[model samples]
Target: MAKIAGLAVGMSLALGAVATPAGAQTIADLQAQINALLAQLAALQGGSTTTTTACSFTRSLTMGASGADVTCLQQYLQGTGHFTFSGGATGYFGSITKSAVAAWQAANGVSPAVGYFGPVSQARYSAIAGTTGGTTTGGTTTGGITTPGVEGTITVTKNPSPASGVKLYEGDSMKTVLGIKLEAKTSDIKVERIRLDLDETGDTASQDSAFYNKAVQKIYIMDGSTVLASSDLNSSTVVEESNEISITLAGMSFIVPKNTIKVLTVAMDAKSSWDSTYNADSWTVGLATDGVRGVDGAGVNQYGPSAAGVFTNSFTTEDDILDSATLAISLNSSTPNTQQVICELGTDNDECDNLEVAKFDFKAEKDNITVTDFVLDIVRAGDTVATATTAYIYDGSTLVGSASVAGTTLALMTATFSDIDWVVPSNTTRTLSVRFDIDDAALAADTFVASTDADDTTAENSVGNTVTATG
Candidate 1:
């Protein structure tokens, strides 16, 4: 009975060690179950169980390097509180981007953190990425991958000229001549600098620096009612050799949001002191090809005229725009009356200094007129043309000019006055009286009449426009 009980005990011990119909789990099986439960828990919490892959840079990056990789790097730096430019992550690696990379390297304890991104920085970045839990999809960092196509583009078009056919006066200020339209695609764009081309297209067109300076005293760029930038025409900003005008808005920024168009007006202050010879000159202002420089939201440098191509790169105004002021002249109603004069018989000539011969009024319409010279025609009867020796012009009893008569016969004669400076104020009329010195030889009865030819008068305004007279 003792042997049988010992056998039953041994059999019970062996059965306890063997597999049962319930199929109990081993240590490995229990561990796998726990992992599966943890994965499920991670999913519920909006996380991945596997480690995510971060952006990897194969080659070194420095300033001027641009592409998807650079954008990715910039985005990464921005996420890590390194890149902090206003426009966010642009694909181009500029000075600002370089500084950002240097900052990231210093934070990660990388040696010689000089703004340059090399293999050492990439290895460190990769190590950190491996420990992160997000997965990459495209190029942007949703989880670990960066969003694709982050770098935006721009389309440039020439806006219509506001003063296309309108005449621009020399003294006109803030006259809009050309317009440029920039359309941002996909993301916002910040324009940094712009270039313009000036083209003159008339008989009196000139490429002289002085001419350009006088023609365009001040240049202004405007967006609606706001002024974006401005510059006075100078050798530094306006280059005569290239016919290029560069306007850099260093501290100022012009931003065009995604899918929006910004129209920039190019206005100028037409100086009132250009050479009068350029009165018939016409000028056209336009945008230069590949002249617009700016950064997109992805920090990529964008140059234009991108979409419009070279055909629409510039906008031209109509030719034959006059740069002059208007002045009108008319004869005064109180003109000197025609009369006969008696001469002494004993003298070889009779000198009548204050004999008023003619009177005329000069009216300056738009600008102040400076009458420099005049020619008066004298008609006489019963006396030789030599009877009138000299003629004088008086402005309210003040002598303004004097001229000598020339001729031999009594038919007709002309007295010319040159090199005189007489200013006629704008919007005001000045009545001038003319008197003649008549030499009455032989004591003969003589009659004299004086008249001024409107075309023979010479005058100019402040803007160099020759004044045409009419009565």
Candidate 2:
């Protein structure tokens, strides 16, 4: 797309006739050196020249018109180059004077005699004035006349001068009107709308107004410019519009099938999660509800001693006390023992349940019990059973060890005596304890059944006694 080779220079004038004839030279000194060599070839073909005389001949013309019919066919075919006018002299036969009268009637072999002027174009303007040589009005030598001069006018203002200008390329036929028409494309050619005034400092003229649907196949419009407006947009239904965003026909539907591009992205507020203000009491109030009856104060166990031994009862009152309970503590000694039960509930006073009933249950047996020194005075309680109650130490149901009790004796206590590590669970005969009781209202300890006056049913002297094993 780079062409600029226009350097034409040809000047001539030699008409002779008068006076004492040295070498002659006078038809007014050869028509003033043929109007100063046709005004220096109409200022070097910027355009203009005309003159015509028919019958006895006389011709001189230069025509290459562009706007306002280049001053009306440069004043009608300046130096009448035997007729060639398509645009200038703004007599508007625009299309660069029909491509310079179809390139001067296909370089004079004829046939483009279409519009503007007729009679085979005035008989090819009297056959370019009978062979162009100019001069006559009596000193007659009209043999086949060809004076070819006197038609003058040339005006070319350069700047993409092929008339109305337009040439962007890349798959050209942008829907027609002399084709290559454009609504958008900064890279793949095709573009119009006053050539976007030629890149007005890069986008943002309010984003150039809008109307670009050119049947969209791959449009990115804004700056990255990657247009392919339909070669049937492949890769499964392409529809990529983006001055910031607009996409349709994504995975496949109306057949956008050639090389695909359906991308849309531009809602930038960091990436929107939407909170223009968000209402409806912000999600109504914790949601899921139902199940309350501590003597029915309506929903969430509403206030005061909500049942489960309302005040105290070695702990007993169940409907799954909020669904999880098991608190067993037995300690009967017949001399084959190891004992430790430091279960404390919380509300702080070293917690054993100082009325801070949010939840607790205890378990203890070998939370750290390993006594095997002499074997016989072991009465360890808590064999796997605790949902919450601090004092933890079990091995049969896995808790392992913890006992530090004194937040003021756990506010009011029901279970203390903190430290112990008794391990004697081999041939038990007494000591079968278990502990657990979840929803507490301050220690109402239950699930305890002890037995010691020794009938010796050995499971290690009955660990905490209740011996019953058969399997």
Candidate 3:
């Protein structure tokens, strides 16, 4: 009876253990139930979410980005016109991602097919995304946008406000300041001032005036046109007036860059006035007019052709008269000759033997003589004797002296007279009488031979007598 009771108790214990929740299920059965509950939870959440096979995407959106992040980037690229997804946001960064990056680079003035979001391109892209202000402290665009990254559209404000600045970005509308229209390939730039100066002299005044006239013609003196001023001495009425002209010149106004500062020293015609003493045939003013003394402190000076300074005396006459006689002598040549003779014969033969003469029988036979700072020559033929002789110069009845003519006397010597002074005395007459005395009786008896030394050969034997006189 006790052994039966023990068996029943053991069975009851086992049954009791089966009824207990914690002690009833096996290890495998418990594991299966827990997994079933996890499946149900995933279904409630709309998928089996055991971290979703690590949530991967086929391609990467950034250098290190991959998995689901790349899928989000593909959607963003399509929304931004960077790519046309053939498979509608395939969640894969494949050839479509590379094509989009390349197209963005080409449109944004960037180079290369580097499929990475570089810092420069990223910054530009950020500006386009309105994320940060695209402001540069150095005042120039140093980089451009190409690939997409964290940077977004940016807004720029001129720090010094009121002054104009510019802003631009890729794949976005550009906003320009200062009403400037930028060219497609060129940037708008600003320039500063430009200036010129024109000054003319009196000698060049007329020419400058003509140039000024031509320059001003058809051109308006607008704000950008040229300015002109007169620097003419004639512009001044007096010594003090020059300052007024200068002041007027200084005050002259003209356009900015377009207009040039021209100073016209217009020349006036030569006029005779108190200023006549200052006016010269080759009149010039300023430093160029040397040796000119200013009449006043304002640079007004006396300028004229320099005097024909230090000229030697040069006198000549076509006709000279003596008492009732007239001697028409041509003393115009630079070198002139004077007649000289010596008389040494008895007073009885003085009329023919001891007399020397240059006879002009008719008025048409006047003497043309040239006198210079030298010796003299007789113009008439046979009027001069080359023999070694003594001659006496006489004016009417006055006896001058007996001058000797050696054999070397220049009858026709080619030697020119270099130093001889001869002047006709005021009392000279038309007939100049001279006497030649031949001391040797043999030579005195010899008939007078015509001298062929005379330059005018036509008058060789024209006069036979020795005491030839001209009227």
**Per-residue lDDT over 337-389 for candidate 1, one digit per residue giving the tens place of the 0 to 100 score:** 65655544323445565567778888876678888888888887764533778
Ranking by lDDT: 1, 3, 2
RMSD of each: 20.4, 35.1, 37.3
Q: What are the lDDT figures for the candidates, one per model?
A: 0.63, 0.26, 0.29
lDDT of 2 by residue, 91-143 (tens): 44544453344334433434432223345645664555434433232233222
Q: Per-candidate TM vs. native? A: 0.39, 0.13, 0.17
Count residue pairs with overlapping backbones in model 3. 40
Top candidate when judged by TM-score against the true structure: 1
Question: Lowest-lDDT window of 10 residues in candidate 3?
Answer: 180-189
Better of 1 and 3 by lDDT: 1
Per-residue lDDT of 316 in model 1: 25
What is the Cα-based TM-score of model 1?
Answer: 0.39
